[model samples]
Target chain A: MAADISIGKAPHPLAVLPFYGTGAGFFAALAVLLFMTAGELTGHHFNPHVLAIVHTAALGWGTMVIFGAAYQLLPVICERDLYSVALAVVSYVLLTIGTILLVWSFWVFEVGALMITGGSLVVVAALLYTVNTCATAALHQNSSVQRAFIVSSALWLLITVIIGLLLAINLRVTFIPRNHLDMLKLHAHAGLVGWFLQLITGVSTKLVPMFLLGKSKREWLLYAALVLQNVGLVLFLADGYFNPITAKMLIYAGIVALGTAAWLVYLADAYRNRLRRKVELLMKHTAVSFACLAVGFVLLPMAYYFTDTRWVSLYGTFLFLGWITAIILGKTFKTLPFIVWSSHYRHLTGKVKVPLPKQLYSERLTVYQFYLYLAAFVLLVAGMIADYMPLIRVALVLWMMLAAVYAANVAKIIFHKPMITDGNRTQ
Target chain B: MEIELNSPFAAELVKAQTALMQVIDPELYVNIVDLGLVYGVDFTNEAKVKVTMTLSTPGCPMGDAITGGVKNALETVFPGREIEVNIVWEPRWNYHMITDEGKAQMGLE
Candidate 1:
């Protein structure tokens, strides 16, 4: 079957703007915080300050973008409008307020009323988003694997946030049965694998084909990935809590590795079948992210073996910076231009000459951003493993530069204006 | 410089085409005519302007939105003239159908 290119009625672009804006803000903040606190970060991954920084990057930057992108892409993916625009607005407001307060409370190492309040607000936001997306998915009668992945990922997101809230309260009331660090690991994995990775895989399955003008016949591969990833994540969490056995950990790692391998194969097949001969700049970055994911999966088992904090940090750096952040940076450039273009120039089309979506931003700047991001990602992993604070600081600087360039590009697209003329002008 | 309307049908057709330029393909961010969506326009005896067009895809969810856009554009241009916008699927649109001006705007040239 041909890929679904249904031009559905998306929610107002403004509904998703706050998320993109806040996500960018958090990314910048995380980069700056990392640069300033590099010295204090050595061998302190579990410190409250470090947790604050991680969450700033994870929730503020990563999850924020996912929420906004989901709202924009769901209608196109599912062939149905969003269930409720009002709920989307409410979710955005609550998430913004919640993220700010939670990040603040974490910075001060306060697990008191402030933390509780922030956590509660975030929980509510997650619930609202879950309900909206789930309801939208239910409207589509066909059982698409992509839809299943998306809905299940949303459920995982809810679970991740609920666990987070409990962890926050546990810090104060001491009600949790498991150790704090163990619970933290469970919470992190649930968000990373169950939520972010699953959603990315699902969305990419549809997008890779559409962007490449290719056909994907391997539906079974996608289903296998979904099953392996969720199952592996659950078992991994279980191993963290109850088993703590090396054999069980290895089994979980192997399952996740198989899922990653399947995903890589799917992408490779899509690329091979692509009709578009020239790989665009966005796809270039996407390829780099896939390489990062491959390397991270290889190191996963090793990271489990070595009980060193450095190895663990290296694993996380690869997972977050290499795979997640890289893909986001790449896909943002591809999607954002079209969105801003439609918003600004939809009414002016054919009446007068208008720039194409590609003309809205500088391609040269995007290339530079990709290189800087890749270099920073490598340096970060090396610095973490070696406990070299200076290298990490330099990496942080590079990351900030990447973020700034991206922000500037997006702003250019958002604020673009066309010159009016009687006739259309050729580029 | 103002030009004389040689014929009411000809003048109305020009005005209608100009109005249709205001209706855009929301996803492509280009007007339907430029996007090769408007196949043809016919003026009936009753002064009704009928537009035959197709979407980028058959399953396009913005079908209603673009159809509404066509009606509004025609009404604004010729207030008293009746308007009929018909969506057809024959002779599917391709990138080759884009006009030189549209191609230039899209950087396809």
Candidate 2:
């Protein structure tokens, strides 16, 4: 049957641009914060500046862009219209204000009304996001497993943020009966595994196949992964909160590992059947991201055993700076250019020759950025483990450079103007 | 994929389809015709040209681009003839729809 030509219009560019713009801005800010706090980093994992950087990267850089891309993508993935652009804008405003306030509070090591207010705003934003995404998903056929992943993760994010707010409150009043550090670890895991990992897995399941023009009939694997990962995470959080310190945590980690394996295997099989045989630069970045996931998978259990604060710091670095940042860096070019290109060039398609999405950004800069990032990530991980301050400093400089290059490329996409065309059939 | 030589529209349809070949799927880097997105080329009410098509995937991120390309492609061939694209979901697109030439370009066997 003929579908309506109106087509499910994706989110307006205005609703999304702020997130990507602010996200890039946050990354640049994070790079500067890294250099400024390079000295304080060698100490305990709970240092103020490190906390600030983590929040900035997690909320501002990572979640902000994800929220933006999600608006543009969920419509396509779920094959339905976004429930409300206005709701999305409201969430972005709250998220923006909340993130700035939270990062500032962390920077100054404040645990009073300021931090609590920031945490409360963040909680509301997360709750609003949950409503927006779930309502959007509910508007579509419930059959798409990706919707389940996304909806579940939104719940986890709400939970994660609520726990964070409670933690902020706990910091002032010492009300939480459990150890503060233990609860903190639970909060991080709920966000990381429950929110980030599951959300990434769910989105990628749809995207990888679409981009590759490949089909993998491995729905069972994702189903298994969804069940195992979520179940494992819930158990881990419950045990961590009640029991506090227990060897049984390793068992829960194993369950999560198995779930991660299902996702990895699903992706590998999809790649095997890919019609697009050549893996391009962006896919290579994706490969690097999965590798970071692997490194994280191995380190997850190690974090449980290692009492060394250095291991904890390294864990945070690899998870945030490596796994999250690399994927976003690569996918930003993949998704954002197309979003911008559609905005600029959709009407011009048959009328004239228009640039493909890939041509909108500098390939040379991206290649340099990718290689520089790899080198910096490796050196940073190595430097931290080896207790070498010089290497760490070098890594930080390289990271700042990478951040600058990344911002330049993002700016290039965001501000890409329409090229004049002679209205020739150049396709 | 046969042209009816006896029909008055055969030559014009061939030319129109040939022009449509330039409308490539940006992500797959293959022309829509060879990619098997075009289902038919026919004359509609008042000699208006109609191109029936489907995307490689339903609701593809590139659906609008390729469809816009189709309009421009045909407009150049049949100047001033209004072109309408009717997108259908029937027998939803599968990998086998891709022609051998399309497969070769994508490095598929």
Candidate 3:
């Protein structure tokens, strides 16, 4: 089959820009908060302040970018416009307010009305996003593997949020019979593997090949990944409820490992066949991300087997900051430049000499940012394992610098002024 | 597959196509003609040239940029001549419409 080069329209950049900007702001703030509270967070992941920090990073920074990118990407892949731009705006507003309120409530350890209201708003926001994505996907003429990945991932997002809300309510009501810690583990896994990883896998399968100018051949690998991931998630959730610290938990861990390995293999094949001989700096970060995913998967089972809080923290760090955050950073650098260039310089094509999409940003700055990010990530994992406050604080500083560099690069692209090479007027 | 070098219209067509190579679909990193976006070119008796084209998707946000690029390219080649660009959705563009050169460039060969 020939490659689908159809140029589908994207939602206006304005529709998605707020999410990226706000998410970056929250990420920068989280880095600072991490530095200030490094002493308090040492070996205590479940404290209210720590919870606030985690949620701010996960929901405000990570999921926020996913929401925005989805709106911009889904339409192009599906060959349809967004079903409801108005709904997307509403979702963004609700998500922003909800994330702020939830973080504040956790910071003050107020598990009362404030927490309930914030949690509810987030749930509603997730529901709205799900509706919008599903409606858009429904318009596609044929069923595709990409569609399966995206639609199922959206469903997982809904489930993850709903379970989260239940856990929040249970904290006050004492409705669940199981241990709160075990339930919390379930909630975290559901969000990380089911919602985040699943969605990332889906989007990357299509995008990686296009970026490399390579053909995507293996459909079965994607299907297998989808099946294994969902099955593993369901099993893990069951294990969390039934046997939180038993050998049976290994079943889910093994399944997740297989799924992750399958995805890695598929991606590796695509890269091997790529026509683009030179691997860009962004792709170098992506390769590191894959390695991080493998490390995290390996550590997950060991963490459970050892039953050590330090090991658990290390696993979370590798998965979240190393794998997910690295991929997001890499993709952001690649995607944002094209978006900015198309919005600004596309009109000048043929009429006047214009810069290529890749020329819109500074690659050197991006490379430096990636190095800082990797260093900080390593220090974070080491600090968590050793419970070293100073190391954690230093890592936080490095992370803040990385975020700042990223923001600066994005800013330059957005505000770029084209230098006209030809002095011809538009007829 | 070769243009008649003696015909003024054919010469203009070649010039227009060559200029159009500069108008790339940024996402695909390929020219619009190779991506099969351009469908027909006509030199009308009223001393005007008309180009018909379609985007990969109906909702393409780059519609204005592409149409503008087409006009700019034709105008540069055939100056002082009226240029008309008609964006039609009919006979939708597909990957199969890619020229042999385009196929080779895209590594499909």
Candidate 4:
């Protein structure tokens, strides 16, 4: 038993956390894209609509997925089972319901709804997630890569929730000053780069290698990357909230330096340990996304220095649409197939022959969507930089179409299979 | 495959579930038996025992502890029976696998 169930063989509970969390996040993000695109076309500066899209993506999609990953990972690295599966189920339900309420409040633009119920549910979900994860991790005597991911993720989630509630209340009552949009830049950064990006990096450091059937050796590099990213996020957030000039410059500088280091280390690690020597199309597209991230990061600081807000928006376009969304798109295709395969077909492994996880979806359709998104991303950035609202609107519509294609592709993998496999199996 | 009746230690196999539960799993704070993990037991009159069990999931993290706990408990209980344990993933454990008592304990009722 011990021989067959070694370090890599035994299942990690935290692994599933990332799967469910990322899955929800991807869908939420696509939904936001859909709504935001419509708003752009209709010429409505609907702030509530924007808030809904952002939260749906950040809180609903990003935070939830990170929680799932952390739950699965903590046990493996810490050498422990979760304190309770019941807690996990509870956490998932709260988060799912909370996201729905919050998004609904935003779509309706009801201050009372957003403030009263939306705020409470989001808070409850974040607290539940944090408590469950922290308790589970506390049971382990020693820390692991998974532990690091879970801990940092929990902390950022707390901050993200608080900021979200504050913003929601301010929207409903205007108790806070009207410079709320400016204040939101800080909150948004804290949630996106600090909470979501940090968690993804920590988990992906381990997951990426596991996917490639290789072990991670450079633990120190990962630690350094994590530290740099967090420190940069802290500095960036402080400056955005209090000191605009320094915050703008320092945030850009800090992110570029940190993001570059992390990216380089990521590339080196992938190159060193990567098995299945032939890089798949998903990885190829992912590489392109990283390249876009590097370009955006470097260009962002330059734009800030030149006092070109247009360039700043352009940089955002590159990062949000080009890098982040693109990476999610590519990785989702890889992850969704495996998850659907496991949930639907893992039981039938020895009993009957089945198609591989990669075969669950159409690769050709995904590839086509990837290209369309890339093209749309490029045009949108160009339009934003040139202040061409019409062009931006058109590009956003194209992006919506691409998102639909990606969502459809993912859905086909999950819902295409029946729950019971071969009811005729005799024990 | 078949338990032989000749050795004084053969009866120890029937008590394997009781024996395993005596050992505690520190992480979950529940015995393997109470967790409804032990699936079957086979004993041979030659003083050998075989224990089969299942885990909560394919990639259970505390599998080592549970298996080790079972071995330790059995060794302490029978002292003379040579024990062999097998962990199987077939007919995978789910909520339905839990006994009514286990279900009550788990708050699944």
Candidate 5:
């Protein structure tokens, strides 16, 4: 600590903004793709258009925003600085290029060198990310389970991309003995369960309580969640490798489900004890996210039982767009404004007046975006179930508007000029 | 912040504490004075006003802003004096440190 006030460990805004800006751009593009490919949703999800859409959402929208947020979040969780901003930037570039190439290849049904190269670059990027995250965790020897899950998630990301790369290569060579479909299932679950699930659980454990001014005395529940989720995933991958989607897959899924239940229980405890009794819209979005998760959970077995591909598609929609996107929409406002506020107004503080983080963005736009996302998601799911093209197109139209609203708000924050402050503005 | 009756700087300290009411913690939305983050205000150094205080969390992302608010608030009130904010962690801040006004603002009552 400095005798004179130095500062906390916030990374430079530029290091974080590139990913956020690109991710928002990708999401806007994704909305356009959704509108264009509205017909593809009810068919088998392995089609070219579906593959393109999934990659666009997964890599472009989900992973990119996360990479940017992780720079701010990992430091807070680890109580240390990010190991390398340059590595973070490198990974973002690699991910951007790889996603564009890979998604284009999928769209055109080209499964040759370009796709393989794209997948390879993505794998290398994931590896570098894992190295950076692990190095940061190593800086402090804290044994918090949050750290464990965070680091483990990076490892899972590496595994996911490696599997993805191998799958890409196998399209031509067929080197792996296992069935390609089976390997795809393994890769999907690894990324979904291993990477996103664990990462959200870990990060939310810390953030939820802090934001709510809540406390969870149940460390044991977190430990249980950690053990069950990881063990179940390991067994699942092994089963998918050897037996290739056997009946026992249900048992493994059930075990993982139990692990997820543990984390939910912990979050419930925190919510019950929260000092901030009046919940904000952001927290409400979080609740809706879990509700979306429940819908995905219910769809899981139906996706298994019915050979109809729509169930699986619906499951993906609920999990990715419903659960993940909902939370991101809320959390973006939560963290980004604070980050921008700190960067722009830190020096001006204690000398002149300044605005609060919340004042930097439009709350009205966020409310509209939130409602629009929910309506569009529900209508899309309903449209797919009934095979109604008109309804589906309407939903897609709303989604496109929602994406624009979201992007506009993000830009509003990024470009927020320091308006006049009172001689004594504080909060 | 409490003013001791015996202290010679009690009147100046009172004014200083009153001015700090304008500085609120963004997260908590309560004034630091009411939140009990301000430990003491020392006017002994004729040239500078010394503030001893603590944050609700050590790694507060808004640490700079809150401390800077204190500096600005004082500079506005006492333009000639240099403001020195010395953050301490000796007595960690907890819910108990909060005054009734703070608790009311936090909806903890």
Candidate 6:
């Protein structure tokens, strides 16, 4: 009968920072022609403009946003307060400055000393975040959901940074591998799929159902999916550097099995609880993202059948640009608006009349973006498969345009416009 | 409309229940109806309503948010209505307060 003291009374302002970062990251890519086209014109693969766009998107836009959400959600699910908000703020500052230094180093590749310093700062920031999550879990290990996500995410982050530092050292003083791109597949996958995608899905398993009025009953299936993924990733990284055919096959099989099983369970849950019969744009796009995941997973086994790396690249295209980014965009719509609404309007009740949360969005625009994304993803994947350069370029442009629209929608939510008349009547 | 003096109050109760369902705790992510919070709702007049509810646990952080949400939701349905939310800590909320539907949703037999 004792009350649970852990429930947060208000939506923290710090939590919404990540949403803003996501929106910013989505739009910033267009500014530098995403670092490649600009590079071609300027005859410099390493330019301040390109570095700014890349680092801004990667660290400023992606990692920071993820950090903000985790700081708020991890504590709640764990039924404990975070290790230190002050420490979190410190980590954020270090990461921000570190990213700036990194972009500068990219432009001046001769700055071996500077690269080492920036890389160390990034590692420290990751360490701080890792320590924060692990320390919080040490208290009241009640929520298994929180524990799994925090631990797994932290481990992957450590792996990501360690690999990153080694790469930097190689660039500076040839400390490890001779080939700069040798361990790249491992480094990229560890950070992308292992650290980012794994954490996102793990958290989604809990949040998606809680927000959307669904239930996740297949805990065992989730665990199975998780283990298979990690095993595959580790094995892939170990032997993939040498380009072993058997190792590649095992990795592809493992990824396919993991993605398919998770998708099935998620779709089944969503279908069962959609009795309200009101399918939001976010849900529609989320299903689209899962379809991309399924297709990408299915294509993995094809890599063994084919001898070309083209199939592998196509599979990567579907997984990264198609599945991972799509999910992030789709989920951000639901989560950002809610966070903004709660923080801004929760206290306005009883003082006077207030507009409903549903009034804050244009459902029409969101639905359009969802359909456009589906078309763009399909075109892009097909182009990649067919080796049609023109089609691939057009699809990327379309993807960028849709992403721009999504970014603008998120920006409006963050800025907090009066969506209805007489909005100020409620204090 | 058929005029029935004896049970004219039945329609008002249904209207009140519908309004209550719209109220929700933003943080807990559950509405008052499913939280087993609403104990009773009494209507003194067409423009006056009283709600009696308990929290999941004593000193729940969501106590104020849920109460505010209930008031807001009701006011929206029946504007300028006099609403009073009474927070009680008696027979403290447990599995018993959960209706069969709520139990099913929670997967509790």
TM-score, per-candidate, Cα-based: 0.84, 0.94, 0.87, 0.68, 0.93, 0.74
**Model 1, span A203-246: residue lDDT tens:** 89878776764566787898899889988988888778885445
lDDT of 2 by residue, A143-213 (tens): 67788899998999999999999999998999899998889889988999998998899989988887776
DockQ of each: 0.15, 0.51, 0.32, 0.04, 0.42, 0.15
lDDT per residue (tens digit) for residues A1-427 in model 4: 4324332122333345334544544554655554465434223223566556656655565556555545655555544555566666666676677777787788677777645576677777778767777786787665665467667767887887788788778877787543676667667667666665666666566556544434446677666766777777777766666654443555455753675576457656766765435566776666776777677767756655765455655565566566666666777665555545545544443234445566778899887887887778777767766667777777777776776677677667756554446544332
Docking class of 1: incorrect
**Candidates arranged by TM-score, highest first:** 2, 5, 3, 1, 6, 4
Interface RMS deviation of candidate 4: 16.0
lDDT of 1 at A72: 73
lDDT (tens digit, per residue) of candidate 5 on B7-109: 9998899889988987877767788999999999989999999999888765566777788889988988788999998988668777789899898987874
Summarize candidate 6's per-residue lDDT along A1-427 as a digit string, tens digits. Answer: 2233443343355634553654355345533344244212222223445444545555655676677667656655565556677667777777767766776676555458777777788888888888887887777635574367567877898788778778778876776644565465567667766777667767677666655545556676667667766776777776776664453455555663675477358647755763334556787766777777777767767754777766766665566556666776676666556556666666554334445554465666687778777777787667766767677677767767776777677667777754333245422
Model 6 reaches an interface RMSD of 6.8
- The 10-residue segment of model 4 chain A with minimum total lDDT is A5-14
For model 2 the local lDDT of residue B49 reads: 90
Question: Could you tell me which 10 consecutive residues in candidate 5 chain A have the lowest summed lDDT?
Answer: A1-10
Give the alpha carbon lDDT tens digit for every residue of A285-383 in model 3: 888888888898788777777756677667767876788788878887667666667666666787776777777788899989889998998898788
Query: If the candidates were sorted by their DockQ against the true structure, best first, what order would they fall in?
Result: 2, 5, 3, 6, 1, 4
Residue A101 lDDT in candidate 5: 92
Relative to the unseen true structure, what is the C-alpha lDDT of residue A378 in candidate 1, on a scale of 0 to 100?
81
Candidate 2 at residue A130, lDDT? Answer: 90
Weakest ten-residue segment in model 3 chain A by summed lDDT = A1-10
- How much lDDT does candidate 5 score? 0.85
Best candidate, TM-score: 2
The lDDT for every candidate, in the order shown, is 0.77, 0.84, 0.78, 0.61, 0.85, 0.63
Chain B structural similarity (TM-score) per candidate: 0.85, 0.91, 0.84, 0.74, 0.96, 0.79
Ranking by lDDT: 5, 2, 3, 1, 6, 4
Off-target runs (Cα >4 Å) in candidate 2 are A4-8, A421-427, B1-8, B79-82, B104-109
